[model samples]
Target: MTRSESPDLSVRQRLHPSSPFFNAARHLKKLILPAIVVFLVAQAASWERWLFLFVVPSILYEIYRFFTVRFHFATGEMVVRDGWLFNNERHIPFERIQNIDFTQTLLQRWCGVAEVRLQTASGQEPEAVLRVLAVPVVEEMRRRVFEFGEQAGAEVPPDLTTGWESREREFEVEDDGSPSPAPVSDRLLLHLPPAALMKLGLIKNRGLGLVLAGMGLAWEFDLWERFDFVEKVRPWFSDATWQRIVLLVAGTVLAGFACLLLFSLVWTFFRLYDFRLTRHGDDFRLQCGMTTRLSATVPLHRIQFVSVQETVLHRAMGAVSLQVETAGGKSEGEENASMSRRWFAPLVTPGQLTDLVAEIRPGLSLEGLDWQGLDAVGRRRLRRRALFLALLLSAGLALLFRPWGGLAIAILVPYALLHSAREGMFLAFSHFAGGIAYRSGAFTRRTSVTFHDKSQVISLHESPFDRRYAMASLHVDTAGAGTAGHRIQIPYLSRGVAKSLGEELATQAEQAAFRWS
Candidate 1:
């Protein structure tokens, strides 16, 4: 049933009957260890078998929730009433609903249902998550939400994405002197083929998590003992010939490194397979994943911050990753959310960065802006600070190891000086008519941009050391910028400049951002 017309929305509707099962399944991961604990304890005491009593209620609670939860699309708001006993009723305004996305696991896809997630700028979690809904119902909900949004005069940002300069896209104007929304083309922004994904897997180096998983599996299944890893390898080190020893050692190291790279590649593929990003007016849709397909739409206006991230490896490969921090998408710390945002455009070439950034936020450019760097005093301060840290480290090591500890000074001092010198070149900040941008990191460069219209708070931060050197950090804070995995923070500016910039941005934000509410 489409179930999406005006009359269908006016009355309260229960989630699909399968919702209770999906809700139960969502909690299964949390219950795994506890089930194991109960089962093991049952072997000792028959009374412990009753612990399933605890497990039963936890599993069946969602059944109660299924019976209780009721949602209605009301005038200008979606009202969700849940938990008959505790009784929570939420009226989420339509305009504030930033995204209405769908996620379908393999099982859900099989069941012909999907989880419906509604999000706002309030927090990391989705404002409302309907455990499971029929595919048609979910589609209807999404359509109605956006339809109501447009009816309320929510204008889609024109040319906010790519193809802006070459094209002028307007609403389909009606003969009655009213503009109606048109079906905009889903302009393909970027798509990752397998070759590029493999390259990204190499550059991203996500093998650590895989390595840890391998170790856990080995521990769990007693694979270490099964293979006799230690005892088998001991003979190569103990009694093998010098040439044989070298060969075995080389072989072992190569095998381990190869496994690590392979794991990284596999992990990247699982997470980023068939990655496609498309833009339809202000909304940018990201679809990815090999097994569990996800379709997420991020509106342009909700985007609070944007960042270009590059590691040393990425730079060497002449590539970078583009990340967008929407007003609220997902928590930065969450693996799933982090992955989606992190790989927003996992592999971007220098040529793509400018056009891509311009699409995300019009008038924001990476090229030929009046960039300012940390001057000589700031450089000296960073060097001196590094040298001081090195000295303390050397002194501590010398006290501990006596003679060999002084060798640390030789290694650390030069490294510190080199690092400071590199920062002098790479670390810079620019404040222009469009927005404020910061370029930081000597080895792992990051360039972040936030427009004045997006800036929420402007402040200057100074430590005692900063005060001593007359240096401070100016931060242009926006809503959810912290969780977006980037910030518009320009460090090591002269105190005067920091204050001036802070005041300037604050004034600009007040004038531009105040209209939003």
Candidate 2:
């Protein structure tokens, strides 16, 4: 049934054939308990009979809303007409729709329906949310919406050169429901060797610290406890000489350290056990979830950029963490949007990481990888700047503390210089080939890769210090992931490279303006 011939005249236009009041009343029953309690309280705490007049009007206003609200969804726009005495209508074009999120609460699940939220770039209260139909209907609506978008030049067809048609057609079924399929490749994108898995487990996760602390608390409650090795050994050396006592103490300390290392190893392995990644057509499939099963198929081109991060410890261990950025992929609030979810590789060899990237993105190729090696001149300059800054900071600290000033300054300089030099070397180490690679760290080292297509906005700037160094920082913004926005800061690059790269990125984006699905 088409929308034009519908007899639901009260609704000038409707996305679906149901009345908004029908949906609202179905949901309004949920408020009955609270509403009844409020009414009883109002009756008992009444100051005057006039107060009852206000309550009566408030009740009528809610009742009026129960029957008056109307919403409509068209191919190109979604419109909502609401309110009582004052009427307001909101129309959102499909092109402006950032995402269509469908959520089913426990109650909504029982009723076999879900809520469809239309989020756009426009900042508004309540957003454009609608109570909608079943999951299949939502999927169908999404597909139809995409078809409508194609008409308005909002989406580009996938490149046929990539053999996407055969892959896409595999999932296709005609209106009559005949089978159309393609051969599934058994080739894997990643294979985790047992040694790699063991190394991955030894890495520290911020969450693991909390988990271990919780376990220790539980041990105090008799849920578990460490073996009392010290108590057992003390009796054995109760009457021993001073030399024997010292030897026993040293052995106990060594044993305790071993136990701690063993525990950490066990914890890491279990968290990352049997980790695997596979590619199915243009989608990257990740199947992992320890307590809860998780399976997500991320569209390849949808990835905004890729980030490889490491800490001081990780760098020494020869491992880097990789994060794939995408738009509107987070399920949490704005604060956690920048973080990774269901995507982590505790330890991967550099060669393995390169292979993974090549498999996932054909255009992402890093050739002549030797630029990651810093020259002697660059290293010396970095160390010098670090040492000079450290001395200046120590002098400032000496001025603040007088009595122990010498001792304080003595300890601060070396510590700061070492930390600064390490960080300086980390940032200066970068390589660019298929795309641009910039590795950065002070505490946590990270290498971010920005592809030609994914680079949306590129800007350059030079501080006074940068001007003296004959360098500038290039800021590259992509389409997805992170809280603030898609950005990568590459510092100390030549001014020419920064400006030229920015111009090239802008041109590529313009050429591929409508290339997203």
Candidate 3:
């Protein structure tokens, strides 16, 4: 049979529908806050008799939305139609499509459905989402969307439907699935084990966040006055037993820290459960999460930069985290925090990191490069800046708190010297075959690799201090590197070196292939 004669062809042409229950749940989720407000207003105003006016309309609207929502492909574009009163429609062309991500909540997995998000280079939220579709349908859509090489008259494989049905049967056969053979082209890159995930949690700086959250909650509930720990403990301890008091305070602090660490471990386990990275064709796919499963696809050519991050703890353990910057930036704030901008390989050894980078970008290597350090003048400038800032901070503190704050100068001076030394030791830069790498940070070292050709702008910057020292900084900008604007910053280089490097990068960028989409 020709492609049009195949049953799968009919499926492809047909307008795909979303799950009714999924629509209901989504509508309910949206109305929850409004419903609460309405309930409260009705109670206060003694308008309980009119509650049905709100409830009935909401239910009816959700039912209408469930039936009206539909999507179909037409004329090389995907058309999505939804909304009741508004009648919203979005037509997205195939070429505008950048990435297609799939996600499944625990409930959706149980129902054998998934949510597909279509991302474009618009730097906004997803262009479109197939909210709820059967697993087979989702897979088929993905194949059709990504496999642009297939001809318009191309026939669907005869076994395509059968293969999907077989997969479904296997899923139904067991709680997880039958042990199946791996795909021919798919290669596993890295899988974070339970121990490694735990380490990631331990190394993460969650203590400050937790402390801030606790303080906010205490203030909100006015709990500080109700059970003040210092007040309560002070009454129980004898003023004369100074050593005992010191020991008690230290024990309490240790216990609190232990609790925070335990919380971090549990949080990390759930956040990054069963993390796995795999490569297929020109794309790298990452799958992770516990309650909510996330699948993100990153095309090799679209990756603007790759970063290898190592906190002090991670370095001590010989481990690092890998992240990549793609063309489209994620939305701002915590709402989109879980979105796909930061695809993480939680904990990988240094050797494994090198292998992973090479796998993602064949010519790119993370090791054995000759790194260049800052000049002596630049190092001295940094030290001077650190000392100046420390003195300013000490002065402000002393003015605010008198005697106790004056002691801060003693602590700040040494801390500033140590920090400056660490920065000088840590900062370095190097040029690779197709890209340049900038390494920075003291406690948490970060190495960012960006292609010279993909750079949107290359410029040399010099402050008054840098000018006096005959030094300059080179900045390279790219679209995907988030709010920082500059993707690569090689600070503290000689003026001549900076100018030459900038010119070289500009020339390379002009000659390199530019493909954002």
Give the candidate order by descending TM-score.
1, 3, 2
The models' CA-based lDDT, in order, is 0.74, 0.54, 0.70
The TM-score values for the models, in the order shown, are 0.81, 0.54, 0.80
Q: What does candidate 2's lDDT look like per residue over 220-279, in tens digits?
A: 433332335557666878899989888878988788666666676665555344455655
- TM-score, prediction 3: 0.80
Q: Supply every candidate's count of residue pairs whose N, Cα or C atoms clash at under 3 angstroms.
A: 0, 2, 0
Give the clashing residue pairs of candidate 3, or none: none
Q: Which number leads on TM-score?
A: 1
Model 1 agreement with the true structure over 386-478: per-residue lDDT tens digits: 889988999899889998998899999998888878877888888999679888777888888888888877888999988888889988877
Q: Write the per-residue lDDT of candidate 3 for residues 37-145, one digit (tens) a residue.
A: 4554454455644654565666666567557776666555666777767777777766566666777888887888887878766776677766677886777666666
Model 3 residue 387 lDDT score: 97
Model 1: pairs clashing at backbone N, Cα or C within 3 Å:
none
- In model 3, the worst 10-residue window by lDDT is 1-10
